[model samples]
Target: MPEETFVIAGASLAGAKAAETLREEGFAGRVLLVGDEIERPYERPPLSKGFLLDKEARDKAHVHEADWYDKHNVELRTGTSVASIDRAAHQVTLSTREPISYDRLLLATGASPRRLEVPGSKLQGIHYLRTMADSAALKQALAHGGRRVVVAGAGWIGLETAAAARSYGNEVTVIDPEPTPLHAAMGPELGGVFADLHREHGVILRLDDGVAGFWGAGQVSAVVTSGGAEVPADVVIVGIGVRPNTRLAEEAGLDVSDGVLVDQSLRTSDPDIFAAGDVANAYNPLLGRRIRVEHWANALNGGPAAARAMLGQDVVYDRIPYFFSDQYDLGMEMSGVAAPGEYDEVVYRGDRESREFIAFWLSGGRVVAGMNVNVWDVTGDVQALIRSDRPVDPARLADPKTPLAELA
Candidate 1:
């Protein structure tokens, strides 16, 4: 059995965490961590905010120090991609034409940034915030400050980048097809709250708008909107969304839908193979539905869960989905799963206008999801309420005096 080797494709947050967990769980197996990025596995959350704003925060993005991987006996292979997965052979072929066999394999291939197919997208000075190199390039561009920055897509990354750009004193204009930024995720009401926050910080909002094409001589000089209006720009950032990297799994003939379909234990259709992180559309027992979350929290928690399952430990990843975002002076933490239009009513506590409040999405008097804006020490309570599945009184939920713990 070659002492049971565990091969992990993609040196992502999940993959790295799995490697760590394999050893922590008393699995004395050979671990091969492969990745396409040359850098060691690092936390991506800081790339858009801390690393971009402060020079000191650059190294803070690393998940672990350089020696830590070696100390843990993990063979870190960067700048290498997985060419294919051989399901029957229980092996994976690397881009370098090397074959690695595994008793258990993890596919934490994650996702790639959706590229803009519009004309002028190939032009220089246009960027997408995904990798360390991308962030470094954008940071250099924003360092001079006073550049005309047009951020297309009002999603979380777009909004965070716009906020960072504005902080650098760049003339920033954010565009999105929705009526308000984050309308789909936060709903129009709560989304409007963010819109106001950006406007208050001197950010120009071009809502219900999208980019038509780019217009520039060589470098990106302007963004042409669908309305035929040209917005001047020295730098343009596109943050539409990401698509899971499921080519290997699909080619391997594993079950694939929106992402790699996995059971509660994060096991793929093939017993020996597993998937986690942003690429796994895992079944959340708590929600009683299959959902894929592309957030820091999932990648952080899912990795260990998948590892434990691979080790034949009885585990179900039932952690309430959670994610937090920081933009300008506004900071928010959210837990539970509530898609757009899924909740019947939004019960608010504190002031929404002032941006210090907690908004709960209740379905039939039961809290499905909750978000705290500029509010701290309530995420645990909010998650508890959601997991308890108990109906909460609307009046008490909306009342700031009613402690979230009491509701839980």
Candidate 2:
């Protein structure tokens, strides 16, 4: 077995960032980065946002280009997957049926889009946005616009795709069984605002509903609702959520909960193996709990931390939860962890109707979490207050007149 060689599975955000950090930290060990996608590490956030609108937007996510990867001495193996991991042998089996030795392993296999398993769900034009190919397919359908598009899910991906479809002048409709959209991520009170935003933009909105199945001979022609309502469509997009890709880990007998269970150090059940990104069920210090965060920030931040730990450097992933979404002309930035109905009240710092706002989840004058829209600059302050757990006047927080820095 080759000693001091580092191997990482899944070369998306987490895997690539981990490799970059490992080399930058002066670790001269041999590095191997494996990815299922046949492309170098590129940003995913733009796939659903900018790339849908501009073709050249692909350059936005080129993390380390081919030249850069070569200069960094990072061995990037794309279009390959870890079929199984042999912890005892310190080897990982590749999809090509090759076993490679590793002193340390980081499983960063991010996630795949959740699919509707119902009949006709396999029909053509029924798509899921998770990869560059997925985006390209949808983007081609968006060209010249005017196609009737039905989106079956009001999650971040679905909504953002709907926005992109609308921007291209496509007739887009969003359907979800939730009473309000994004209720799980953003609560009902805030999720309702999102429902309004879609409606105001002329996208047909369906709440408290779901798809029955697809209609057509080959390609999707229309969407049938759970309650027997029929909506005509030329394309269907489903973005319910993502499932952590852990089949290889599970088959290898690694401990798996909702995700790969990892300690504060990002190590898995087997000490030689580690996991991060959407695949890592990591311990959250601020929340004092084990949580799986499905965001670019967590994947980017936690990946390097896991790499440092593998390289014998003590590191802890303790950055506040950070994520954002762009839809319509509005941009949202939010941080912290506050559960629903746990807070006694919410404090608003900006106007709601103007499409700019920052609301805090407050309990007994202590800020626990926050929701911000078009106020990206203040997410840091909101994060500080939520983590500080210090007291503040509710009236001051609610009052837009008060200076935000005063609360900190």
Candidate 3:
């Protein structure tokens, strides 16, 4: 008797990782990976970074090159969408009416970029960086020198694209309602450092402002701020954030709160079904709350966790939840979670002035979360220990003379 088929919905990072993991764990099953995208599994982080820098790397975006899936005996289906699921019948209805039965299912549908709802948002030159098509369009709009680009958000995607635009010698302006860029993620002190950096790069920073919409007849040639300031723009990009692509799970009557809610084992309310990646609002043992991490690391780690759980290995899915972003030669790394200034003050390792620093959030005189700029490798042990709330010497944390790993 053959092993039961494992059907996966979505074929991007999380889905592809799950299929690979299943094979690696010696699961002799029929793996059916369904995805709506025609392209193979590719990295999204590179789409905003290296892919933007080097045009040739676009083809290299696929995580698994050509015959890797075949060698693994994984049936990868592209350009196909899963329309519905019959949980009782253990069958999935694809758009093509091809019903496939599965012994297990992994929901890694991820999230979609939220669009700007305005008059001229549908116009040309207004793009959102979510998929290859969006990136390709934005790349074309930003190709020429001296193009007036307006980015309508201070979030990761907007800032990243703004940095890329500035690198390519484009006249860039970033508008956001936040007082400083990354304030939500990095807090005030670090946000100010980021703000200063962007201003230093000659990026026109419009703080505490938002675009009412776009202008021009066919293309978004201008951005009208909330205060009625019309900033001229050759191209407009919106990167407010993404909403979880949880409609399929919700329609299938699966429990969903913000995202498809899953236990620590990455199993959904329905035991046969599992959810991972940006689509899974999982219970965080460290934070003691249900949180959905949108980082690439989550997609990678969570996929394997779900697969392990499905295979009856039963491993606890308590990943460190690390993420990194590089822009304008500055690298930012984060580990663990912060609980609303549970830290009295951020302890520093290096000078923040030079932008080569590690700041740790403290609560009850113990480190909770750590952020390092251009010093990610050193953050490993600190993250592992701090994420577990292991006691550390405050003196060692503040002392540049002391090695952080020593305290860990």
Residue ranges of candidate 3 with Cα displaced over 4 Å = 339-343, 391-393
Query: Candidate 2 lDDT, tens digit per residue, 1-408?
Result: 334889999999999999999988998888999998997887788888989876456767777777877788888889998888888899998999998999999999988888898778988989898888888898998877999999999988989999999999999999999888887776677787788899998898888989988888998888999978989989999999998988878988988988998888899898889999999988877778788888999988888999998987876777777888899898888787655665777777778888788878777889877888887677777887877879989888878777767787
Best by lDDT: 1
- The runs of at least 3 residues in candidate 1 whose Cα sits more than 4 Å from the true structure, single-residue gaps closed, are none
Against the reference, the lDDT scores of all candidates come to: 0.91, 0.86, 0.86
TM-score of decoy 1:
0.98
Instruction: Tell me, by TM-score, which candidate is best.
Output: 1
- Displacement of residue 228 (Cα, Å) in model 2 is 0.8
Better of 1 and 3 by lDDT: 1
Tens-digit per-residue lDDT, 1-408, candidate 3: 766999999998889999999999999989999999989888798777877755457878787987888999999999998899999999999988999998999999999998889878888888889888778777777777599999999888989999888888899999999888876666666778788888899999998998897889897779999988999999888999899999899999999999999999999999999999999999878778788999999998999899898898877787767788888978988887653455666788888889998888877777878888887576677676586566677778888888776776
- Residue 298 lDDT in candidate 1: 92
Cα-based TM-score, every candidate = 0.98, 0.96, 0.96
Model 1 weakest lDDT span, ten residues long: 52-61
Counting clashing residue pairs in each candidate, in order, gives 0, 1, 0
- For candidate 2, list the clashing residue pairs, or say none: 43-61
